[model samples]
Target: MSNIGSNPLIHFAAGATSATIACVSCQPMDLIKTRLQQSKQTKDAEKYSSVAQAARTIIQEDGITGLWRGSTSNVMRVVPGAGLYFLMLQMANRRYRARTGHAMTPLHALLTGSFARAATAVIANPAAVAKSRMESVGVWEYKNGRSAVIDVLKTSYTRGAMIQVLGDVIYSGISFAMVNTTSPFAQKKASPTSQFIVSAVAGAVGTAAAYPLDVVRTRVALSKAQGKDAGIVAVVREMLEEEGIAPLYRGVEFVALRRAITTAVTWSSYRAITAAVGRARR
Candidate 1:
């Protein structure tokens, strides 16, 4: 409930801290989500069987770094996104309370948070896409089929980063809105032990909702790096033809679990930070 926007430094600091924490805590699940999202079943599905299996496989194959494949992009996207989100939440909460003449409730918090997240997603879509791509498929494919981030970026660049970013912004905004709208209701009805269930559900729903765009973004990013021209429509059609609609929601469970943990951590931390700041100010 602090005026985060009014104090730019504090807002930024809080945002940075929050983003860092959120990314670190959820990176493993994020890796799983990316893998699932990017999974393409050939004649035989040569992919991890489940989320747990995926984690173990990644560890066995690529070491811990594989699990943190997109940590850089995650930091880039999250720091700004989270900063904007927290700042907006404070601003929105204040406005909502002033207009309604009531204190912040869970519903208010949820709506405001969702709106802020959507806004940030719009701005940070390209980065988010880049991060997801970097995490899921790496930057390039070697002759044998594996690539690095830099190589991937160098290959992809047809539409330019700006264009991709714009597309991402739109996709992210819609996705965040969907996730936010349903989260509060899910949480409200959940049992105490299952409070985090809603967060997971929201994450999964959001991932699925945004996944087609995510696939397009990934193809665009990777194709650009590979010097190929694959439009969003073409990519969507290709994915559908090759993998069917189910592929779009492949990594949903991982996304949901990651989201649940991230949300719980974020809210808990934000509350703690706000309280500490309040005590200090007082």
Candidate 2:
């Protein structure tokens, strides 16, 4: 087990694999969540009515595929985020353990995880923004909307991916820190099932913390979809003025659920994979 801790490549592979699996597993819910978030109750109070009702309507109208509308982009965004998040976390944990000559405490785990997640988010933010925009409602309805993905890449290049990347770093850094910090505390006295509950709570906290930035990113990305250029502040202001603060956190509950499921799957799969790898090595 300790030897496995030293193998960076193995850890990276495990993290990437686990993240991919987690993303694929929860993609449908993620799509639904995004749609719900994008819905404007002010524009049409009857649009979705409720998240549960929205889910049912999407499933009925678009079938299973509707629930996974932007799955490809979602997977792309998640793979790197998850992979790097865990890789950084494991590496951080190893260093922390070596320094203290103790197994990772829950607090340590939280800090390491948060740091890793933040780092990954920096690298993966543009793609994440693009994915969120692609998953947004009106963006795809326009005839030129099909080009939104390409436009996102082009706009990102023009604006410098660095800016978007930095935003992601800050957003993920704070969000992960909060979640990771609290998660271990929750898990400390929990049973196995209770640990899952703790993780879910952590995920929800993280999502809520980062959601405002997510809204800004989505709007920025969607602006390109509409053949416009707008920075994060501009987009946020537009949303606030046009839709109110609620629009900034459109699908918060869904985001929470998505994060919770993703966190649970990520940790569970990571543990399983690490164990399997350790067994195989032995």
TM-score of each: 0.70, 0.78
Q: Which residue pairs show collisions in model 2?
A: 37-250, 37-251
Best by TM-score: 2
**How accurate locally, in lDDT, is each candidate?**
0.58, 0.64
- Model 2: residues with Cα > 4 Å off, grouped in runs: 1-3, 40-49, 103-114, 141-151, 157-191
Candidate 1 lDDT tens digits, 37-132: 556522112556578777887898889877877777677667877787767766665677689996555455545555565567666655565665
lDDT of 1 at 26: 83
- The lowest-lDDT stretch of 10 consecutive residues in candidate 2 is 140-149
* Deviation in Å, model 1, residue 171 alpha carbon: 10
Any idea what lDDT model 2 has? 0.64
Off by over 4 Å in 1: 1-8, 41-45, 103-115, 138-216, 224-227
* Candidate 2: tens digits of C-alpha lDDT, residues 1-282: 124657877777787887788888887777666666555422433556568787787778778677766667666667777777777766776777679996665555555555565567666665566566666665554223235446556656334244445544544454445545555554566455765665566667767776676656555655654466877667667778887887767777777778888877776677668878999988
